[model samples]
Target: MPSDSDPRTDTTVVAAPTPVSAERILEAAHRLGLRYFVDDEGDVGIPWRCVVVHVIFQDTRAVQLRGTWHRIADTEHLAALRSLVEDWNATRIGPKAFLTVGDGGIVRLHGEITYPLDAGMTDAQIDDFVFTGCRLIVALVREAEEVFPDSLRGSLEP
Candidate 1:
């Protein structure tokens, strides 16, 4: 088949998949016991971080799994970062939490936080948030090393 409007009338054009983002890496890390916070209302009343960790299984055996340790981050950039992570998790790492060794054990993890200086947000507050958030992420990553398989440890290691 051939068409003037179609650039690749005979050839198939395939687009590459999107890459993962620091947020998703952080999210997965959170599931493995990481935490962070995102300012929602701009009120900044008290420090808020969502922590949800559970264990599920592929069977009815009720086998427990590692929990997530996620903290909060700036709400403005949440959407963009989340999109990046989802893409990375899907394309790069497939749809598995724990990668098997023989199955090309490679995972892409981008641990980052975007805290742009807002005209309204105070510097001291931002500093506090970053300090707390960084500590939480670092601690969780360190602890996860013991639990996560050697092959599946670290940020984006093959």
Candidate 2:
């Protein structure tokens, strides 16, 4: 009914629906056959099946995906974890790898991916992003396993 053209007519105007939303994003990711849940903060995360993949709202215009690979047992474990981070960052684009060492020789490995809103992310794009995150997670887990024989976090299975 000529929604935006010459408002002189008495026809009803229909508002265009928002193409994407946080709920939609999570739904799209779940469609990839992965289980996801929303946190109290309204952000989304996939921690049901494997390592925690924290999907947080960076701003009104962007969303960030992050997950820690593993927490190290002691300072001696730092070397291999850091090497894995270094190698991953060198070879990958987004989802950069990281290692953190805390008091008492505690150490950990992490990963992240940030996507800014453009025209708006499509459902397929959402699925692809989740899949990519999963792939990165698998690689990091494999590295963690290699670092310490007992560093098995979780299996990347259905």
Indicate which candidate wins on lDDT.
2
lDDT for 32 (candidate 2): 82
Model 1 worst lDDT window (10 residues): 42-51
**In candidate 2, which residue pairs get closer than 3 Å at backbone N, Cα or C atoms, i.e. clash?**
72-107
State the displacement of the C-alpha of residue 113, model 1, in Å, after optimal TM-score superposition. 4.6
List model 1 lDDT by residue over 1-158, tens digit each.
Answer: 11134466765544322332233333444553444433453111112232232222223222222323342223333343355445544654221222112223333222333333222223333334335444443444443343433442333332
TM-score of 2: 0.71
Q: Name the best candidate (by TM-score).
A: 2
| TM-score of model 1 (CA atoms) | 0.26
**Per-residue lDDT for 30 in model 1?**
50
Residue 142 error, candidate 1, Å: 1.5
**Candidate 1: where is the Cα deviation over 4 Å?**
1-105, 110-119, 149-158
lDDT of 2: 0.67
Question: If scored against the real structure, what TM-score would every candidate get?
Answer: 0.26, 0.71
